[model samples]
Target: MENPFGAQTDSESGSAKSYALMTARGPQNCIESLHHPRPRAATRAGRSGVQSDYGSSKNLETKTPNSCPRKPTRFLTALSWQYPNEGVIKINTDGCRKGEDGHITARGVLRDSSGQWMRGFAVNLGIGQVLEVELWGIYLGLKIAWDIGCSSAVVLESDSATAVHLLNKNVEHFHPLATMLWGCQDYINKNWVCSIHHVYRECNMVADKVAELSSCLELGLSTFQDPSDSIRSFLSEGLLGVCRP
Candidate 1:
């Protein structure tokens, strides 16, 4: 009868019998255990194979909490746009995107401490991601600022938090906008004092208006020595007293 549990066959039995007879001089204890495998010791981990006993670690349970994580609540505080300090200029930049697949536009306006527009630019980037356009606005705005000889204590403000975060880190990354960001950093290093900041979209109306111009204009890039009547009016309106929370 065939053994389902695989009892030794006749040939195997004959071989073992011969081998045992040849090794009759060997210890009886060693020879007895060779035919039957020993059962493994039971573990506290049960059938789930034990790695190391978790109970042995004193700090393991304390390190990991049993409760589920909760989301943090964020509140928005109203902010009013303001001008820079004495002998300083504030460059406000914004990027406009219609949608994920739509066109992108970058625009920026540089204003003196008195909120007078010194220079502004609008570039139609055709189509791109929002971050790319945001960084581009900073990059091109810095270049224009440098060209116009406003190198001292320039404060750049952008509504894009992502762009400000990257600028503040001052590190190179594998991001697609890394080149432009590095270029902006290079400008910052050359300047006496350059700082990038983040602001709410409502507080950045002047830059937003310039960015809106990029979407409507047919030009790839337009540098304004003097802003148009509409843009001039917009900047004049924004120069009013700062709104409070």
Candidate 2:
């Protein structure tokens, strides 16, 4: 069987196929798009076989009533995982879905201020959207942190800016993933001190790699008290303060 987590694959024609990560807009833009009403155009192709009905409003309508257009600023920044403060635990989590088979997986890793692994978990969620799985990762991470008595001070990080934005904002009850979002909010609103932030995927590779292990492991949630051999190097790199561009 092919490795779902592999960065590259061999094609039948003896060629190599590489997968590239998609870069999403910043949290502000994502939040605006989610909350504002925009004109819809024809349905077009989207990632992971999902059909997208959203289209550029510029083509549908020249301008909206009293709308002011501003050019978005772009800049380059490098990202790296930072250790938590004293007596605090940093949690990094990620969720992924295989495009071909539609297998959804979520994983999380918790580390202390010394950059030592506390606990890690991976779950095979069967099938779901990228956003749903992302929320699952956050919820599972928080649950594990609370169970381990580390809820006093915890910092949660996720690569999905949309997921982070949703948690920070007031989500509508009729939203598709409202229940899952509410569960996450319950943990955040607890007596503990938990903060969530959006980080680049490069800073979350350890959790990303752990999630990939679900593709080969049995269905359900798996916990790891020690870092796997596959992700040890990634953990080491973070400890060394290596930043990714």
TM-score of each: 0.64, 0.69
> Candidate 1 — worst ten consecutive residues by lDDT sum?
48-57
What's the lDDT of the predicted structure labeled candidate 2? 0.66
Tens-digit lDDT track of model 1 for 1-245: 33221222223332224323322332222223333122222121221111111111112122333363553443434455676788988888899888667687788888999998787776666666788778878877777787778866777788888777676553544454555566566666663577667777767878887777554553245566567766766776667744433
- Candidate 2 residues lying further than 4 Å off, grouped into runs, are 1-76
Q: What is each predicted model's overall lDDT from 0 to 1?
A: 0.61, 0.66
lDDT of 2 by residue, 88-183 (tens): 898999998996767787889999999998877766666567898898789788887887788577778888888877776666766777666766
RMSD of 1: 32.9
Task: Show where candidate 1 strays beyond 4 Å.
Answer: 1-77, 170-173, 242-245
